[model samples]
Target: MNTVSQTLGQAPSAHVYKNDVRRKLLLIVVFFILTVLAVITDLLCGSGTLPWHVALNGVFHPDQASPMVHVVMWDLRMPVTITAVLSGIGLAIAGSLMQTVLDNPLAEPFTLGISSAAGFGAALVIVFQTSLVSFLPVDYLLTANAFIFSLVTVLFIGIFAARKGLSVEMIVMLGIAVHFIFSALLGLAQYVANVDQLQSLVFWMMGSLQKSTWTQVGINAVIIVLVVPILLLLSWQISALRGFGEQAQVLGISVARLRMLLLTFSALLASAITATIGVVGFIGLVAPHVARMLVGEDQRFAQLMTMIVGALIMTLSSIVSKMLIPGVILPIGMVTSLLGVPFFVWLVFGRSMGRR
Candidate 1:
């Protein structure tokens, strides 16, 4: 009788698990379709709006299209659209990894000073015309500097956290200190800058896609593509860590080593995007929360959904940035900040109330 009862109980749980997997998969498909639509909409709604048919024709047959249409479609709109998608994917995944590794709901690249560090690096180049790498072209000085600074900052924090076995609170505090330091440095750079340099610094910090090139897009694409699959390969372990916390060590997982590895990859993703596009904020913080709400904490599903949600949010933000001003395209970072600030407030209050 006991055996029969156990079988009955197991049967229902197995059925429920299958159903849950189906629902999560369905949500992923729906969100992916929505993301594709958002991308298409972004491609269509620039300063000189191209009709869908014309845009499609230009995309499919650039040689047959008019010279102006080809230039606008390929040279102008395509790079920005592709870069926005890549940046969103990179930032969102980085944020998800940070939150999981640190076990902190509020942790993300922007919140933890990585983005600020990148901005400061770019400011350094803009103010001094200096390049960390002598072989890099003058145009790439800002990008190389931003990448190196951001990487160094993250590695410093990661090393400290690993060696000291610091708690999540300490990690967060360290990140805050780094953020302030970089902000002060950035302000000092701005103070010393001439009018043209100040203008360039301010614009870069605001995060526009106006300067995105095919090269930048290709570099971001390769990094994201490589990093995401490695992350997914470790997804089961990540999910175990999230579910079990410190007890995950009982299952033969080296919590310290895993944390360090995840942090390094997260830094790589965040820094690369920041180097390419300046300091776009909050997509990292927001997208993972939205993904968890949709698909619980299984990193396998949550990570994929986070990327889709991030891409959708960014592409939508791009559309708004263009449409908000009649002739002027507002900075992409400003649009995301406008959307993210209210959501951030709600999250803080919601969590506090939940604790109560």
Candidate 2:
């Protein structure tokens, strides 16, 4: 077995690794191009149908465009586009971190029950608007409840799991438990609601970018901008967990502590986005898996690509939401599910078939 030993022991040459990285970077560039195209299309193809040049002019030289064009491009389309990008980046990176920290390909805020908790919170406000939180304006009520409940769920899991020192398995179990409890509460809220209230709750839960505003976009952008770079700095240690696992523990990584910190960050990012945009599902999940396919499991590249893919998917979904109906905008969550579910299926069975 000397020949086999020699083959296994020889590491990949630096040149080889550099070439691989170049190829992946090229793929990332292509995806970014696609995302830019999607954003431009979104800006140009709304209900008003501003011409590409006119829309560009509206954005770049708003004073030249008519007030109507200026309003549509600057106030409406710009915020939505920015929000979609921010939400996509946040959910995608959050999903990547959750999947890595939990060691579960399927782990995301939705799967772990965090989104459900947020949804339940929003649903509660919809069903009982003014009854539970009378002081807050109706506009802020749902968002406040959703954000609070989502954080409560995370705090519950983190606090309880941290008591035992934040094992991966324990944290995951706690999240699953959080998911079920919140899901039941959501169901109960649905049952007690009147028809109009039920419709409102359902619509919100389905997700919509119709509510996007510059303020929401700015807040989300700040959070994601801060969190993503920090996660990237820890990329090598995070990547190590995939292969080295407990060996990372031996190497003084404090794998449990790292997982806890990452998990908390991921949860916070996902919750904040969900609170603003409603529950846009699966972009978090499918984006990272798609990124992993394009680039390997290297978290640095994978996470960045995940953000791009997520932004692409969400932006496309936003386009579909607008285009599917003439004047009535469809919910973005429905479009994402339609696109993401098929990709998710491909990710699962595609790998199994390839292994064969």
Candidate 3:
């Protein structure tokens, strides 16, 4: 077995255990430090600023707090921070699972057209100016709508990809084709949208937490809580499935059954965020790689570390983004893409350097 597998397989290979543990420990430490910095930076910046002491006092004791600070910190920044963190965690987990399942280093939420389909769904709602979703509570409706559309898109891709049983290459290609068709539809929707609708559509495309509320955070939290445990539980079996597709068939792993279940789960996870938050890329692609680099290739270790680092990166981005414009909020997708793109580019290029 490779060193990474050895570490994950047996309980007591000291070299494997110690190395894995140490790396995870370091990532946790880094994540904690980064999250704290992001929170502090977010609290300290904005169009209107708060004194550090006043903000600190507000956290521990609500009284004797500056009203402006209270509004900005408790109302504005707090929810934004939470949304960014949770969204980051959700996307990161999705990316890692996809790569493992497809056995492709480049398999990612966006690359496979999942995010594109999601963006198209959200665009249809905003561009059409439809109140179809008005029956739902306003705070959560958009996200719910986005999730529904995303699942629909996923279903289309899933059905197409399920020929002769499920194959990773087929699904990936199906996703790519679906993405192209949806991209054109989204453009058409944008073209017909009025100014207000256009603006809404544009912002959703950019992916920002400026409009986020704690209510949305609560909804996202519930979905993540529901979905993640199931994925983590399947980690060992998933690892075995890699490069052993036929072996999986022989061992009674219902290839089609597993694909359907996983696709539904991934659709829920991805669609929930897409409907609510628009399309935030990179976390789903970048976080998993960061996890693997830190803790080797074990999914159990990888998933945990990815969640931690994804939260950290998003929190940091939101926090730092606040400082960039003082009072104005930058769309978060811009920040993540900026940071995540270069790293991913390097990963694509750096593969030649990887030992086979």
Each model's number of backbone clashes?
Answer: 0, 1, 7
Model 1 alpha-carbon miss at residue 126, Å: 0.5
| Each prediction's TM-score versus the true structure | 0.96, 0.91, 0.87
Candidates ranked by lDDT: 1, 2, 3
Model 1: per-residue lDDT, tens digit, 67-100?
A: 9999999999999999999999998998888898
lDDT of 2 by residue, 144-239 (tens): 788778877886777677786767787777778888888898899999999999998888888888889887888788888889889889988988
Candidate 3 lDDT by residue in tens digits, 1-356 = 46876666566678877876787778767776877777666655565656777777776666767787677778886787778878888878777766765668777666556677776767756676443466876555556666766777877666666755657787787778888987888888888889998898888888888788887788889989988888789776665565475477777677666666666666766677766677888888888887777776666667777888888888777866766776677888888888889988898878878731
Select the stronger candidate by TM-score from 1 and 2. 1
Per-model lDDT? 0.89, 0.84, 0.74
Clashing pairs in 3: 46-326, 47-326, 47-327, 143-275, 143-276, 146-275, 147-271
By TM-score, the candidates rank as 1, 2, 3
User: What is candidate 2's CA lDDT for residue 299?
Assistant: 84
lDDT of 1 at 102: 78
Question: How large is the C-alpha RMSD of every model relative to the true structure?
Answer: 1.8, 2.9, 4.5
User: Whole-model lDDT, candidate 2?
Assistant: 0.84
Clashing pairs in 1: none
